[model samples]
Target: MLKIRLKRAGQKKKPFYKIVLMKSLSKREGKHIIEFGYYNPLKKFAYINKLLVYKYLNHGCYPTNTVRHLLYRLTQNKINVK
Candidate 1:
């Protein structure tokens, strides 16, 4: 099954994350089908591309728990921006 989740990146002690689409059995950060967006925890920042995100979501892609929360947050922003 294809899943949507975060892959850890950046330097040690300064974590970043890429929201990705990948096969369920793949290793973390090994390979991904798509690199959708990014998150920086220390800065409390996120940049999610809603177009691609909803495209995957519409196609039955399953998101991780954290990614689900992030998407929930993004929905509000998209609405407010419109």
Candidate 2:
């Protein structure tokens, strides 16, 4: 199972995260299949690769709760409902 989750980085007290694609059994901060985006909690910033995200999601890659919420906001106005 592949997952979209945060990889911890940055210095102490100033947290930054890499939104990555990796296997479920792999170490949390270890190897990643791909890096699709970035999030800086302290700065309240997010940057994502929509095409990559869509491709992964279609392949059954599930994002962490925080990433899911961010994706929801980013795609809200652009997504169409039938």
Candidate 3:
């Protein structure tokens, strides 16, 4: 099953995350099918590709709990699209 989840990145104290698409059973830091967004909790920053997200969602990609919340938060915060 494909899933949308966060992949840990960045430094020790200063954490960063990549919002990626991958298999549900895959390793957290393993190869991702696609990386379409990112989040930095410390910075209260998020960047999600709405088009891709919706596309994947329609195609049956489920977001993890954290990713779900972040998606909600993205609507409340200022998102930076690239």
Poorest 10 consecutive residues by lDDT, candidate 3: 73-82
Error of 2 at 17 (Å): 0.3
**CA-lDDT, candidates in order:** 0.85, 0.84, 0.87
Scored by Cα lDDT, where does model 2 land?
0.84
In the range 40-77, model 2's lDDT, one tens digit per residue, is 98878899998999888877788777778888887783
Which residue runs of candidate 3 sit more than 4 Å off their true CA positions? 76-82
Q: Pick the candidate with the highest lDDT.
A: 3
Model 3 Cα displacement at 53 (Å)? 0.4
- 35 in model 1: Cα distance from truth in Å? 1.0
- Candidate 1 has an lDDT of 0.85
The candidate, 2 or 3, that scores higher on TM-score is: 3
The candidate with the higher lDDT, 1 or 2, is 1
What are the RMSD figures for all models against the true structure? 4.8, 3.2, 5.5
For model 3, what is the alpha-carbon lDDT of residue 72?
A: 76
Task: Score every model by TM-score.
Answer: 0.88, 0.87, 0.88
Give the total clashing residue pairs for model 2.
0
Per-residue lDDT of model 3, residues 1-82, tens digit only: 9989999999899999999999999999999999989999998999999789878887778888888788877765433322
